[model samples]
Target: MKDIILNFGPPEELETKRILEVRSLSYLERLERLMAIIEVSHTLNTAKIIQTKKR
Candidate 1:
């Protein structure tokens, strides 16, 4: 299992949180196929995009 934090937008607080939600969902779905389980967390750190290939 892997835990990932997705940070989007700037310091300024946005009126709606829909964008973040959509992005998070998209990431989860994509990773779900490759990973056993996928979880998304909100954080202020940089985002990491990983690539995996099956040999």
Candidate 2:
């Protein structure tokens, strides 16, 4: 994983900077990031389902 730098700025500026940073990454890096995001989303959804079942 690449080192993350925290940035503080207006939303538009931050989004623009993020887009540029992602564009600079290689295809494999982008795919890895996307997979990580999907995994996190799936994990969160599973947790929510478990909680609902417990209630």
Off by over 4 Å in 2: none
Across 1-55, the per-residue lDDT of candidate 2 in tens digits comes to 6597889999999999999999999999999999999999999999999999999
**Tens-digit per-residue lDDT, 1-55, candidate 1:** 3486565786554425645754667666757744633233322122332222322
Name the 10 consecutive residues with the lowest summed lDDT in model 2: 1-10
Q: How accurate is candidate 1 locally (lDDT)?
A: 0.48
Off by over 4 Å in 1: 1-15, 27-55
For candidate 2, the per-residue lDDT at 37 reads: 100
Global fold similarity of model 1 (TM-score):
0.20
